[model samples]
Target: MPTLTSHLTSHPQTAEAYTRATQSAFLSLAGQGRLPRPVLSQWLSQDRLYAQAYVRFIGGLLARLRLPVAKAADAVEWRVLRVLKDALDGIVRELAFFEDTAARYGLDLAAGPGEASENSSAGFGPNRVTEAYVDLFDSFGARHGGAQAASVAGGERTLLEGLVLLWATEKVYLDAWTYAREQGAGREGGKTGEDLDGGALRREFIPNWTSEEFKGFVDEIQGCLDEYAAAQGGEGVQDRALELWKHVLQLEEGFWPHVNLQDVASTM
Candidate 1:
C-alpha cells in the first residue's frame, strides 16, 4: 500500500488546507500570547481522561479480533493494528503528562472514573458539548467494531478515520498548549519562575505540540492519509473519502472557538 504522504499529496488543496489550518492555530498563539491561561490549562488537564477513554475503547475492539498481532502482514488488518498501536502508545504517554501538569496546577487529573468503571459519564463534567463528543465516539466505536481479516488488502475508511481522529485530537491539544504559553509569557513578561526563557517556556508547556516528538507523529499521519487517498478503487469511494477529510478540516477549524480563550486573535 502507498504511504499516507503519497495519498494526501495527490490532493494538494485538501492537504494544503489541513496544514494551513493547523499552522494558523499554532501561529495565533505565537502572535497573541495574551489569551487567558485557565482556558488552556483546563483543556490540557482534561486531555488525559479523553485519551484514556479513547484508548480503552480501541483496546476493547482490537481484543475481539481473531488475527494475531503481527500476522496480517500485508492486509488492511495489519495497517489498522499499526495505526492503533501508534495512537495508543502516544495516548498513554500523554496521560502521564496530563497528570504532571494537573499537579502543577493543583488540580486533580484523576477527576474521571477509572478505566474499569462501568459508568461512562463518571468523570465527565456537566457540559453538553463533551457529552455529545463522547457519545459520538462511543457510537462510532460500537458501530465499527473491529477490522476483519476477510476485508480488502489495503486499509479501509475506518482506519483512515482513526488516523484522522488521532491527528485532529493531538492538534487540538497543541493549539491549547501554544495558546497557554503565549498568554502566560505575555502576562508574566519573560520567565515567571519556570526556569525557561520565553520561547523555551512556550515549548515546555506543550510537550507533544511543540516538541520534535509530535511533529514526527503528525508527519506519519499525513503520510497515511496520503496513502489512503491514493488507494481509492472507485470514484464514489474516492469522493466520499475526500469529503470526509473536508468535513474533518471544517470541524477542526470550528474547534478552537469553543475553548473560551480571551485575547486570542481570529483564526487565519
Candidate 2:
C-alpha cells in the first residue's frame, strides 16, 4: 500500500505540477549561469515575504496541535509539536540568512515585480504569487466562510491536513533546489560565486538549500507527516491529504517564475 504522501503524488496532474515547479526554466537558468540579477532579486524578495508569512502559518498549526503530557516523547502529537518547533526555528534562521545575504550582495530586499531596478533595493511590496502563498498560509487560520477562504469546515483545517501541507511545501522546495544543484554543478565561474547576480543562488543559496542539514529537516517533516497520517488513519484522512497536496503543487508551480518572463510571474 502506498503511504499517504506517496499517494498524494500519484495523481498525474499533481505529478505534472510538481515537475513544473521543481524543474522550471528558472532553476535551469540558475544552473546554466544565465539568470540576471533582477530575477534573482525578485525571487529572493518574494521568498522573504513567504518566509514572513510562514511564521503565522506555523503559529496556526501550533494552535491546532494538542501537545502530549511531559515526557511523552514517542507520541505522535509530541512528534508533531517537535516538527512544528523545528520548522519555526528553521524559518527564523532562514529569514536572518536572507537579510545577511541580501545586504552582502547589495540585492534589493524590497524588490518587486515589474521592470524593477536591479540596483535599487526598494522596489515594492509583496507580489501576487507571494500574496497567494500568504493567503494559503492564512487559510489554516481563516474563519469559516470568509471571502478569501473557505477551507474551514468546523473551525480550521485538521492537523492531519496541515501536516500534509507542511510536508508538501518542504518536499517540493528540497527537490526543486536539488534539481538546480544538479544543473549548476560545474558551470563556469560558479566556484568564484560571481557568475550572475553575485552568484548568490548558483553558489550560496543552492548549496544551502541542498545541504545535509536541510535535507535532514525535510526528512523529519516527511516522517512526522506520515506518523500523523497513520495515527489519523482512514480513507477520508487520506483523501483530505491528497487534495491539500494538489493545492500545494498548484501554488508551487506558480511560485517559481517562468524562465524568460521572470519578473512577470510576480505581477500575476
Candidate 3:
C-alpha cells in the first residue's frame, strides 16, 4: 500500500514542483561550492528564524497527540510522541549548529526583523516566502494550543493535517539537500571522487544536511505520518493531506527563488 507521501508525490503537478525545488540553482550552487557567502549567510539567518517557529510547531503537535483519544493506551500515540520529542531535541541541536556556523562565517545572528540589518544588500530581512512559511506553522501551533490559544477564522486544523505538513516539510528538505549532495558529487566527476574541496559551506553544511542520521530523522517522521494516516483512513482525510502536501511543495519551490534572488539586481 502506498503511503500518503508517496501518493501525493506521485501526482504529476506535485512531482514537477518537487523536482524543480530539489534541483533548484540555490541548492545546486551550495552543492557545487559556488553559492556566495552572503547568500549562504542570509539563508542561515532566515532558516534560524524558521527553526525557532518550528520548535513551537512541534510543541503544538505534541500537545495534540497527548490529547486523550478513544484508544488512549495505544502504542502508536506513544511512538509518535517519542518521535516528536526527539525532533524537538534535534531542532535544539540544529539551532546550535546555526549559531556556530554564523559565528564562524561572521554572519549576524541578530539580523532578523527587529535588528538593525547588516547585510541589507543580500536582502537580510525576512521576505514574503519566509513570512508565509512561518505563518503557516504559527497558525497551526496557535490552533493546537501549543503556546497561546487563538481563534482560527476559517476553521480548526486536524492532527492529521499538522502531521502531513510536518512530513512534507521534512521530506522536501531532506530530498533537496540530498539532491545538492549528489549534484556536488557529480561536479567532482563521481560520488566519492573528492571532498567538496572548498569552504565550510561545502565541508560542513552539505554533509550535515545529507548525513545518514539526518536521513533517519526524516524517515522516522514519515513513518509516524504514514502510520497515523493508515489508521485514520478516509477520503476526506486523504484529500486534506493531499492539499497540504501540494501547498508545501509550492511553498518550497518559491522559497529557493526568494532566497537566491536576494541580490538579483545587484548581481545584474
Give the root-mean-square deviation of each candidate in angstroms. 8.2, 4.8, 5.4
lDDT of 2: 0.76
TM-score of each: 0.59, 0.87, 0.81
Assess each prediction's global lDDT (C-alpha) against the native: 0.48, 0.76, 0.71
Distance (Å) between predicted and true CA of 137, model 1?
Answer: 2.6
For candidate 1, lDDT tens digit of each residue in 78-191?
Answer: 555665678778778767766665566454443543343223254545223343344434433544432321122133325445454555555545644555455444445544
Off by over 4 Å in 3: 67-74, 110-124, 142-154, 186-198, 258-268
lDDT-superior candidate, 1 or 2: 2
Candidate 1 vs candidate 2, TM-score winner: 2
Per-residue lDDT over 1-268 for candidate 2, one digit per residue giving the tens place of the 0 to 100 score: 6777777777665767788879988887676556777778888888898899889889888888887667557988988888899999999999999999888877887766755332233447666667777887877763422433455232347667778878899999999988987876666534545466767776678888999999999888888887778777875777666767777787888788765555433422
Residue-wise C-alpha lDDT for candidate 3, range 81-194, written one tens digit per residue: 877888899899999998887676666655543222332334445666776677778767744433211322235766778888888888899899988877667456533223
- RMSD after Cα superposition, model 3: 5.4
C-alpha positional error of residue 123 in candidate 3 after TM-score superposition, expressed in Å: 7.9
Candidate maximizing TM-score = 2
Best by lDDT: 2
